[model samples]
Target: MAIGKLFIGRKVRELRLEHDATQSQFAERLGISLSYLNQIENNQRPVSAAVLLALADKYGLDIAELSTGETDRLMSALTEALGDPLFESYSPTLQELKLIAQNAPGFARALVSCHQAYRRNSEQLASLDDRLGRAAALEATPYDEVRDFFHYVDNYVQELDTTAEALALKLGLQGGDGQPILTDYLDSQFSVRVVHGPSAMNAVRRYDPAGRVLTLNPYAPAETRTFQMAVQVAQLYASEAVENIVRQAGFRSEEAGEVCRIGLHNYFAGALLMPYQGFLKTARDLRHDIELLAARFGTSLEQVCHRLSTLQRPGMKGIPIFFARIDRAGNITKRHSATKLQFARFGAACPLWNAHQAFETPGRFIRQLAETPDGARYLCLATHVSKGVGGFRTQRSSHALALGCEISYASAFVYADDLNVTDKSAFEPIGISCRICERSNCASRAVPPLRRSISVDHNVRETTPYQLS
Candidate 1:
């Protein structure tokens, strides 16, 4: 019979240090030789079953739990990092990665983090060039700066989240819909009367601080009204927290700060309307049916999607999902991800993406299984949302929203129920955007990839004008 080494040397050493015990003292206590104890602590020898029991008896330690699938997770992350084209020429073997994961987990984690940061910066650079047509990001606009801020943060603002969660509890959002509770809160707290009617200047929400009147657009749906009321509450009550965040952000322009402040207010509103813990529980319970979630929380589909993306609390994380809204023109207006999939920052999204197709089939969900150029597969869901002025004269505001996650998480979503997720051929090939897309034969590519050599044979007709080399 053979017992494998735990590879939890650092953990054992840490526990010993916590108890202020030397190797000899720990060895004496565990009834093992000092050299054996040293070998175990250095991951050079197996931690015997007897020694494990002794450590538990002596130190109240769960040493076996220390190595519970950590090495596997680390290896998986390392493998994905190596799968990047940047490491293609010099990627270490899988055995080396596994050894690093087992013996030097901390170093392995640090390497993964560094690679992520490097990749993020590179994407930002490419995005800056795409959006602003400039080399330096200093020239970026307020919207650009704010979008990047949220993108880097994984779209979760913790302080604001806590504040909103507390507010949701105080307002009793979990037990009921957001409308009545939020309206009563505004009335009692600020002496503000919530009047639903056509607001001045066709605004969705207008708060007159002096008059203490909150007017909402009558044409807007009940969900919109409730959400705007929450936003007003945030503006009224969560002003300090919002300002603190804006100040700490150190945005280059006051305009960016203002934009960020409004964005925070909206974020607080979403969190308040659908409090994190409650929303997460319900989402999981309902298997993340967007319509069901929307009905439960009294929020719009887009709101639910956006809130789901922010369910990234430290210990109680929801599915890591990417959410975005795109206009008919193919512009990604709002984008955030708690997953590996990021939206194209510079231009319109890929033409073949489900979000674009959403505009064609309004009021119905469009599900897609797609693979990016980086070999990442996702289960994408898209639908269009329309906000009409209740008449034909005024234009109707509509946009397509998309929610997605990697194929590994597809089973958890109701939208993926009928998808041929296991079949590679069923997944359509897609990209972030054509300019940065490395796919050589994308039929929908509008522009050539950046920093890549391409061949243009005018005589030979291909899917794209330029062939990626």
Candidate 2:
């Protein structure tokens, strides 16, 4: 296979501006002409090997920094944003979009922001039609803002995870039992007392910061109780580190920041419960078995699935998996993707996915060999998880947890052992969302695709009511 050229134009310009060097001065250091440097900076010419070597040798810059993952994210976001009906007449080619992301990333980000503002305004205007004379402000929801933040960061916080792992090691929380070690650590370090509160409190976990008391619902399962305790410990002990990350996130609203703080605390708790290296090694040894890993780590299946999605730690990365928790109503409550598959931003997931089917056979795993509309294949697994108070006649919550990775990694998953991964006929087709999917003959399509014209013919009928053009 032929390799693509590496273009570091944006990174070069950023470095030049950071060093406060003019074009001529910087070109002299790189042993290149000013015009050639300008060409490189404008992305008209790819960065030469000599220039890359000079960048590292002269400035001690890391060559890996030249390849910014932000360009790929910007490209994907711009593609989605431009898919709106407003840009139907001006569709840009993928190569053209790549140039925009590489050479004019700032302008590309501005365009995405403008598109988001337009969407918010359009939604507000639609709401205004329902309630006349009431002013509705245009704004992105806090959930969306936080989701976008994690999406751009690829859902990994290295510093916080590392700190949590170090704390785990320092507290002697190795292997056997994490709950008691965590409980003892809180008492010794912060003088905080962990106690079981009344089930009537109706809260999973509550911490009285002023009173130095940590309370948990007595009805929660043992795994849930321990996880909640870890969350509280993260909030109390890792506040400084979590606050620093939140401050640097540059969220547009305070609500977004607050939501991110809670998210980071949850992240720290997961890391504390399952330290990175040990968890990765065990996951690989067990062939990424959720049940065995949960049993070994003394965590829940949901916790194991969620932790697998966050194993994107640079040099020590694990399998790239997408994890989602969907309610019985088909709403995706929690989602993160380390793979190419992204969940829909708004509304429910595609009805075609096995995650919906998992709810039908509660507590049983559903394995699927699936392919997306984009032709990417995956080995998916989903199971329903339920939690409630430990008594009869109490409200219970049930949600389905879905975990999957690319079909190329199927051999590493024990669930794929019974399926034939090489057979093209075995893979079931799925889509990210109904609005964007191009599949025309779908029997379950609820609405016409946004980018395709539909034809309704009275003379003939098929699986679908309309044919897409």
Candidate 3:
């Protein structure tokens, strides 16, 4: 293999560039010389265990992600992108391009960035064109805005979680067995009637303050119910507190602030459902099994997953886990985590995870072992969840979520012990890193890593180039 075509090296160079570090500056940080760094990027040197460890500890990059070059993800993205009609002219030459991706790292990055810029610009242009005024029409409903806000925060806010916890304790609503579902608690304790009915409109959840009642469909999944309760709780108890946080955060727009307020409400509802200690105990006893937890609490898998992520209480923390729900089309609809996974800031996720695969095996829980660029491995459990539309359309849809943690903690839980296969090696290893993975060797990757170069030369296209940056 030609030198300067290494994924790890390319990543090192990108990070060095991002920090604006001269080779010497980066070398100093790694406690290595410029020559050693050069050797690593050039594929002349293998990444050392010491340096890998340092990257994890010092830079906060997951060690497993760094080492394994989760190529499945990269190739998947590229394949999807290449499938577009815009790329049809070059479709016949994809094999050549893939080879370039493996052999010439610089060109691979340039292409990825170029494609990203193109997509962004196209979206902006499409928005501006606004043929049917769809943007404005959707804006009339707060749905898109709220979704965007929650999506922006990845559905978990540490500050809000803390506030909810304090409030739950102060209100004597923090017990495990005693805690009731939000609607039930409201109706039984506060004389509020909680029921399920068709929304007069498309309102996901609504509270009738005048009627002193709350209504959500029995068909609603655990997540929907939890959200409803949160909305109701926010309307009833923490509206003022939510406003305070919004103001403190300096959100100038009233719309944005209101969205935060609603989110805070849901956060409280989740806390109420899963009181820190009570829920944590059950979760541990249950070995953090999601389906069992959902059944026990009358919540959905997503709700259980969300609660699991929030077990980040200072003294009583569960294993750090990442939760993501994606539709069949690969759009990540909801995501939250306290783990080391880095979601791509602006693009789709890797396609190989069970999150997407769950579509094929609906109602079945699938397990996968995923590695990040820094060589961190996690055992993931994924399942599909659905919701119903009550009225005329009577439409139904479903999505999938993957719940995972580092493999070291797998044996500690029942979910880990039941992967359908006893041998860990029998399970396949997958990855999620999009930018810096150097596994030119993988066939399942959607797109090659941005760190690899392209090879236009004849007879010697190295598998996705990891050029010495």
- Across 105-161, the per-residue lDDT of candidate 2 in tens digits comes to 889999999998686556435334323422232336677668656766768899988
For every model shown, what is its TM-score relative to the native structure? 0.70, 0.70, 0.60
RMSD values for the candidates in order, in angstroms, are: 23.8, 22.8, 20.8
Better of 1 and 3 by lDDT: 1
lDDT string, candidate 1, 1-469, tens digits: 3346565666778889999999898889989999988887776776878887898999998654765477888899999887765675887887687568877888999989998767656665766554444434432568878987787677899999988999888767883466787788889988999887666437778888899999888877788888889899899899998999999888988999999988999999999988889899999999999999998888889899999989888998999988998888887889887766666665679888888888889989999999987799999999999986455676787899999999999999998887788899999998887767788777877877765778889898877776787
Clash list (residue pairs), candidate 2:
none
* TM-score, cand. 2 vs. native: 0.70
Residue-level lDDT for 448 in candidate 3: 55
Which 10-residue span in candidate 1 carries the lowest summed lDDT? 130-139
